[model samples]
Target: MKYLVMVQGTQADYEAMRGKASPGSPAWSEQEVQAMYAYMSAINDDLSETGEMIDGQGLAEPAHTRTVTLGDDGKAVITDGPYSETKELMAGYWLLECESLERVTEIADRITRCPQPEGAPNYPVVIRPVMEGAGDI
Candidate 1:
């Protein structure tokens, strides 16, 4: 089976990483950033060697996002960020071909341990099986 794993974080967290002012947390240090990248690269390498990784990518900050919806007349309506109503934004995702949900959960668990600023809370990794056919959808 294939599973999609989504990583979520708060807007404050994103801003802090980018050297912007957030409410409380300080900006991430260079060593912390490097460690995070190293940890993610190691996990990707492991997943690739195990034939579990299909695809993965990190997303830009929510400040750059836009929300689109259908207007009353069927035209597209657009709204700008930074999605004030929401506390968390999707940070990244990974697609994995694995044997079972348990296996995927294990992979997500490892991701949850990826390096972050000290005292930073662990974020949830949302996992869902990928539907490959119309019937499944």
Candidate 2:
């Protein structure tokens, strides 16, 4: 099964993360950051060892996004973004090809437990299994 692990959040929640959540910050409490890093690293290592990890990446802030839309003339319209609704923003994602849905769920649980950088508290990671030719399953 293939899965897309989405990191979703609100604009306000993200602004608060700009500090501790920013790249190369020592702002995260040492213990908390260490624990989460260890957990994430372990998850990655385990998945790689099992040949379940296909590809993955951490994203830059949503503020860097650009939107492309079709205009009446059929030309592409480009614009700066926070994208669609600022109330719900997609931060980042992971693509995994696993053996079973159960395994995917296990990975999702670990990701969801990742410590949010200070102000972004209790943020949840959502998992969606990809449907190939079908619309929805």
User: Which candidate should be chosen as best, given lDDT against the real structure?
Assistant: 1
Model 2 over residues 6-73: C-alpha lDDT tens digits? 77655444454433443333344556657766877787788888888887665666777777999999
Local error of candidate 2 at residue 10 (angstroms): 4.9
Residue runs of model 2 more than 4 Å from their true location after superposition: 10-15, 20-38, 83-85, 117-119, 133-137
Evaluated at residue 14, the lDDT of candidate 2 is 48
Give the least accurate 10-residue stretch of model 2, judged by summed lDDT.
Answer: 18-27
Per-candidate TM vs. native? 0.90, 0.71
* TM-score, prediction 1: 0.90
How many clashes (backbone N, Cα, C below 3 Å) per candidate? 0, 0
| Tens-digit lDDT track of model 1 for 65-113 | 8899999999999988896688788899999999999999999999989
lDDT of 2 at 10: 50
Off by over 4 Å in 1: none
